[model samples]
Target: MTYRADPARYDSMQYRHSGRSGLKLPVISLGLWQNFGGTRDYPGAMEILGHAFDAGITHFDLANNYGPPAGSSEELFGQVMARDFRPYRDELIISTKAGYNMWPGPYGEFGSRKYLIASLDQSLKRMGLDYVDIFYSHRYDPNTPLEETVGALAQVVRQGKALYVGISSYPEAETREAHRILKQMGVATTIHQPSYSVLNRWIENDHTIDACGELGIGIIAFSPLAQGVLSGKYNSGAKEGTRAASSNTTLRASHVEPRVLEAVDKLGAIARARGQSMVQLALSWALRRKEMTSALVGVRTLDQLKDNLGVLNNLELSADEIAQIDEATKDGQMELHPSPKGWLR
Candidate 1:
């Protein structure tokens, strides 16, 4: 069957301007962090992608080291682009990142001119993209000189390999410095991708959110559901095939602490009162900030994808509801995906 995008795609989903820039991303963007990697997963990933675009989700986020085998997700995305999504390229906001351990040896990872430039090249090849909509340093490289790292990012824009550049999971001070350095180089540091959710408010505690707000950098929160801990999925126990039960996943079963589960149980009650599922509550809470441009979600199935999009139905939270949520979660039971004062995934 030919893939024709929904003519009403732009009708339902909401878009917020990314920082002060002219670019606006859908309030909910799809991320290919997992389950979009395997050769056998292609058909399923394709269907999810189609449904997402049909729902007005224009942005798709990825990283160089996203796949289980590393680099496979981009290959999968490229296959979809070639087969079904090629005609709709102009309607999509495709972004990828580097700066994690991709291959072995010194040049395979980190934020260096050598590694970043080479990684983006490989990513462009793998995704069959002439240029990505956004390219980010996947994590802050304390070992690398910030100048060299930011310089490579600026260079890519000048060379026309990336349309815009961003940073992910960076601490507050480094984020400010990166913005300054990019500004000096005549590039706008467009967005900041951080791990922010009800359970993990590292961005708020560390002042990263304030810094980005003051600097006019848009925020797109990843792990907004604490990798599904807040989804009421693991409140009972580690279900089969959940991220918590899987040893390969970043969110280990051990990470879903007992106290956090208790806190989430209370939240589930509140969600029911508000006529929302736990997933919708978490996502809506993340987007409550005016500075937030989008909330990035990774879905394994068409059902999960549609369920996530349901957050848009009533993103509004009453003041009393906010206070109730704050009190319920303020016990610091937020250890499920607890990020330390300075850094986290």
Candidate 2:
């Protein structure tokens, strides 16, 4: 069947400026990191993608090393784009990244100029895209100089392989340095992707959020639900096929300890008082920051996507509510697992 998007898709969706750039991204962006790989059902993936667009999710976030075999997600996305989204290409924001172990060799990953450039070329090919709206250096590399990584990103823009450049998981100091270097190269760092949620607040402690605000860089928070811990799905314990139950997944059952579940339970009660689900509350909290351009979420089903989009309807939180959430999760240490590509898994 030919997929025709809902004409009124944009009626309720809110678009926010990406940093100081002229581009605006949907506040609730979709991420193709998990459950959209080769092993997953193509028809099911297409259904979720179609529903996301129908509900005004224009930004689709991806990375080169997303799938188990690596690059399979992009390949799947390419097929979906060719089949259903070809005509609406101009209406979407596609972004991909590099900086993880994509291939076996040393040249296949990291922040080096050679790796970034080649990886993006491969990513563009896999996605069947001429250029991604944003190309990110997926993570900071301590081995490479800041100049080299920023230069590679700038070159991608100059080559028309990417419209803008971004960095992910860089520390505050490194993020500042990257922004400075990119600005000197005549291309300002457009956005910064980070892992932030009620249970995981590293960005706040590291001051990355404050730095991005000062530098005019947009923040798109990944793992806003703390790998479903904040979603209240695991509050009772890991069920079948949940991230905690899946062997191939990064989020393990050990990570969700008693303390974490207790925190989640308290948070859930707070969410109920606000008349929202735990997922909605977590997402709304992540977007509470003015510097947050979007809250990038990953979903396996269309129902999950719709529930995430409900965050847009009620984003307001009183100061007291914020305090209650803080107190609830303060004792829990449920940070996302560290991966080569940061916490977007």
RMSD, every candidate, angstroms: 2.0, 1.6
Task: Show the lowest summed lDDT stretch of 10 residues, model 2.
Answer: 336-345
Candidate 1, pairs of clashing residues: none
Q: Which stretches of candidate 2 lie over 4 Å from their true place?
A: 252-254, 335-345
CA lDDT for candidate 2: 0.87
What does candidate 2's lDDT look like per residue over 1-345, in tens digits? 889999999999999998888989999999988778877777898899988898889999999988756899999999999999999999999999999888778898888999999999999999999999999988888888889999999998899899988998888889999999889989989999988887888888878899999999999998888777788888776577677666668785545888888988998899899899899999988998899999999987888888899888799888999999899988886655344444444
TM-score, cand. 1 vs. native: 0.96
Lowest-scoring 10 consecutive residues by lDDT in candidate 1? 336-345
Score residue 181 of candidate 2 by CA lDDT: 87
Scored by CA lDDT, what does every candidate get?
Answer: 0.87, 0.87
lDDT of 2 at 313: 77
Model 1 spans with C-alpha error above 4 angstroms: 332-345
